[model samples]
Target: MNIKPEGRFQVFANIVMILITLIAIIPLILLTIASLTDNSALIRNGYSFVPEKWSVYAYQYIFSSGNSVPHAYWISLVLTASGTLIGLTITTLLAYALSKKFLPGRGILTFIVFFTMLFSGGLVPTYINYTGVFGLKNTFLALMIPGLLMNAFNVMMMKSYFVTSIPEEIMEAANIDGANEFSVFFRVALPLSKPIIATIGLFIGIGYWNDWMNGYIYLTKRTDLYSIQNLLYRMIQNIQFLVNNSSSLTGADKSLGSIPSVSVRMAMAVVGVLPIVIVYPFIQNNFIKGITLGGVKG
Candidate 1:
């Protein structure tokens, strides 16, 4: 029955992790419960974990508001998928190039990437450039191109992973075997770097999925292009306006009272993030592996 120090430490760590998991999950459980609770109960009791009454009226109000919900879902799915693939491709190519010490202008390129991480052209100029010059506003490109496409952080992480984890001798061997740079990269480098690729892909995917600012700013008149987040945001705004200005309209008081504004807000949160939470567990292993290995210095 004697236990080693390591065994005791392992048990303690498991206990700590289980407690942390509960702390994180309990709020989400409460949020879903609150979302399902009757709006009157929510307003009266202030979000009890176990409310007296339950209702799906919030979700009904949300979906019945317009035909926009399903369209928004499709738009978000396509935007996230396309943006992640394009962003990851660009990131991987740029990182692979920068990882080579002998590449001409490598230092200058690395400096530029690092400098971008520190500075930007400011909001006005960026907005003007993307909208006026590039004519990206009101287009799908607005969502995929403006800011979420690529960035220095992912590039650096991928570059660091390539340089530290991939062996120079292996690349050299491929070259000596008459393989071109493309061949070496495709056959030797990419296959061996699955963890980093999956990690960065997940990062880009989540960013695109959660992005609402792009749609809000660029798709003002292009309401059809609004993603799920943008649609829900607009719904929330409309509800708030109704609640705030209820005194102005003739029947606004009754209308506002009937709306499940309180519970609907929680329902929107659950809807916005539920898909990502469902998908994360599938790639959690590669993501953790990537972060761990890519962070090390040779």
Candidate 2:
């Protein structure tokens, strides 16, 4: 068949897109299959989609961590939700306030915020300040505060979006109609910023959901307060420890076959990440829109 140039190009583009989609989806399929494969099957067949045996033992083992798994999930959910809300609000307010051309000290404040993006007090000083000076250790504040709050880069994205996307005339008209600054910001400005807010919220939410460092550093003495990532890290460590000492374990213990193998680790990963996967599709449109609008424009 003699295809036209445009038809040939369309066919090539479709093939490339399909390939890219498969590349992204294939790993998730493998991850799910590997999680369901029995420990012995994984050991023998190496990570095949069709394994000799299958078991839910890995999931059972993960859940068997007592209340730890559920509690950690709760902590992660709370932190992700609260952190996203608080971070987005603060970022929007700062960005909007700075976007106002007439605001006093706007230039200086923007410069200061931008400066922090380039330089920060090193980890040691930050640790000392949070742990010793602020005494946020072993508290929910440890999980919620520190690195997860109010990113300078996100602030700048929001500020740029405000400056470029929002027309100055809209705010001016609102002001002329007796709208106070607070009313203008809350009613007019925020309603127009859904794209940037959703995008920044997703970034902040993911950060909080996946964060383990804050819990590791500040909640050292409080295992009960560990987030999902922190708790999962400990689980992986415990599994390795058991594997290392497997020889020392009695024969009966081994016969019970309670030790979680490679599949269990994959299962734990799926558990940790499944929620984010489920949530992403809903916001995908907004995420794309936000990124497109947030691009640097000359």
lDDT of 1 by residue, 1-298 (tens): 9999999999999999999999999999999999999999999899888898999999898888774798999999999998988888999999999998889999999999999888988878888998999999899899899655468888999999999999999999999999999999999999999999999999898888889989988887899998998989999899999988888989997788789989999999999999999999999999999999888762
Candidate 2 C-alpha RMSD relative to the actual structure:
2.1
How does each model score on TM-score? 0.96, 0.93
Query: Which candidate ranks first by lDDT, i.e. highest?
Result: 1
Please give me the total number of clashing residue pairs in predicted model 2.
Answer: 0
Candidate 1 worst ten-residue window by lDDT: 146-155
Q: What is candidate 2's lDDT per residue for 1-298, written digit by digit as tens?
A: 8999999999999999999999999999899999999888898889887888888898998888564799899988988888888878788889888888899998899899999999999889999989899999999998887755478889888888888888889999999999999999998888888888889889889989989989988897889888889998888887787777778877745643776668888998898889999999999998888877876551
- Residue 256 deviation, candidate 2, in Å? 8.7
In candidate 1, which residue ranges exceed 4 Å CA deviation? Answer: none
